[model samples]
Target: MIFYGKQSIAQSDIDAVVEVLKSDFLTQGPAIEKFEKYVAEYCGVKYAVAVTNATSALHIACLAAGLGKGDVLWTSPITFTASANCGRYCDADVDFVDIDPSTYNMSVDELEKKLQKAAVKPKVVIPVHLAGQSCDMDKIYKLSQEYGFKVIEDASHAIGADYKSAKIGCCKYSDLAVFSFHPVKIVTTGEGGMVLTNDKELHEKVLLYRSHGITRDPKMMTRTADGPWYYQQIELGFNYRMTDMQAALGYSQMQKVDEFVSRRRYLAKRYDELLKNINNIHLPDQNEDTDSSWHLYVVRVDFSKINKTKQQIFAEMKDRGICLNLHYIPVHTQPYYQKQGFKDGDFPNSEKYYEEAFTLPLYYSLTDEQQDYIVKNLVEVLQ
Candidate 1:
């Protein structure tokens, strides 16, 4: 069966991890710093802090930005729960912004409308780069300036993607950006994440927060104590540091990021050409301005024209050895959020997307033969 997404591991990636295993340190070692440096250099950001996973990166990023009780955090509903849960991690009120029906990213126009009617101003706004296609950062950046809200880009799917010729994690348009190195992502570290920022203060805070808020740097100590043995617990933090074994794998994978992205883009282009002729299906959009990493090749079915419902289509595809999967459910529709007064109609576009959108097979290692089989099975299922 063709998986919807998967890792592309090689001897080099395996060797890197093996070398780490043979090294003197496995966690909190030189490999972690090396990996962080590689990502920071690649994204052209000043600092990169390695974390256990993207969710932890999001939580620490929200905390570093001062999102807490009495503050509202806004994000797109069409994303993994971590995008919204990061806000709740800080005891902040969470709210959803509808997505653009075409791009499936947070809609700047909807955000503007919501801000106008919002009883309280949001302190942080997280715009997810859904399916590796960046949200309109230029417009969102303008809104951020006008509304005085901090921007944290949920760029987990977009490490190798470019937004207007700028790397996604450069933070040229936002305060901080996060990337995932999950197995199915552009790169694999088994499970890891990184936070990138241009601001020195935020960078320092992220480093401190990722390691239990304990600072060994004498400069950051609250009071002058003994000798070099002096240290301090500056603030409450968590053990979110990524292991060196994971970092070694990430470092090796980072070397081939361009190649992985290029392959994925090529496959996506092929899928786009083949699927465009099909009726009752909407393919992903990639205008000349936005270059996507093509993390997942998603298509939305027009249920009105198709004889089968989404469930029936999904079941048929699965029975035919095609592992299709949905991208997300509207976060506000979750039972936990419903108790917070969120309901189905809170974000119309997100609700509509959840009903029809599903991801098809996409990965660097996926061959043309596999893709052909997937497309043929999909066509047969729809028929």
Candidate 2:
């Protein structure tokens, strides 16, 4: 069966993991640092802290930004729930901005309007890089400066993407940026994530928070160490460290990121060319200043002209041995968030996008034949 997305594991990836398996350390080893350094250098960032998953990365990054019970954190409603839940984990109230209709990223215009009217402005605003295309970050950065807020980019689908010639995780316009390394992502670490930042203090805080807020450093300890083995628990943290095997695999995967992204971009262009004449669907839009990694080629079906419901199209595609998936349901529409006083109509654009959109198969290994077949089946169903 054709999956909506999947990893492309080569012999090198297997060899890297096997090497780590035969090494002295498995959990907290040299491989993790090596992987982190490679990602940092690739993204042109000063530091990168690899963690168990993107959720944990976002959690620690939020804490590093001084998010607490009384603070507010805002993100796009169209993202995975983890983007908003990170704020909830820190005891900070979470809110969402509407998405831009064209790009499906957080709307900077909506953000500025919300900030102008908010009685209590958010301490942090996370602009998610939806479908690997960046939100207008220069504008977001300007707003952050004017309104005294921090920016964290939820770049889970954007590790290989670029905005204004700079890499997504460079943290040029945000205080911190996040990347996911799930099997389905551009890079795979089995299941891992990284938080990138230019600030040394933020990096230090992230390091402390990832492993139970414990510090082995003499400078950070409250009192003198009794021995070289003595460590201090300065604050509460979690066991969010990446394993050596995972890091090694991730490092190996990073070596071929450009190739992976290039193939995906080529496939995306093919889809645009083949599907452009179809009147019943809207292809993914590109922003002038960004080059997307094309993690998921999402399309909006114009159900107004079609007689079939969204469910019918999904079933038809599945019957053809093709799997289709939605990127997200609006976060505020979830039962948990609804109970928090957010209702369906609160963010009209996000809710509207949710009703019509679903992802097509887009990944490193999707060949031209498979893509053509997928498009043929899609056109047949939509027609």
On lDDT, the candidate that comes out on top is 2
Q: TM-score each candidate.
A: 0.98, 0.99
- Compared with the true structure, what per-residue lDDT tens digits does model 2 show for residues 1-383? 89999999999999999998998999899999999999999999999999999999999999999999999999999999999999999999999999999999999899999999999999999999998999999999999999999999999999999999999999999999999999999999989999999999999999999999999999998899999899999999899999999999999999999999999999999999999999978998988999999988999987888999999999999999999999999999999999999998999999989989999999988989999999999999988
For candidate 1, write residues 1-383 as lDDT tens digits: 87888998889999999999999999999999999999999989999999999999999999999999999999999999999999999999999889999899999889999988988989999999998999999888899999999999999999999999988999999999999988889998989899999999999999999999999887898778788777789999999999999999999999999999999999999999888898888998765678999998889988888789889988998888888888898899999999999988978898988888999999998999989898888888888
Instruction: Give the C-alpha miss distance for residue 219 in model 2, angstroms.
Output: 0.6
Q: In every candidate, how many clashes are there?
A: 0, 0
- Give candidate 1's TM-score: 0.98
The parts of candidate 2 lying over 4 Å away from their true place are none
After superposition, candidate 1 runs with Cα above 4 Å error: none
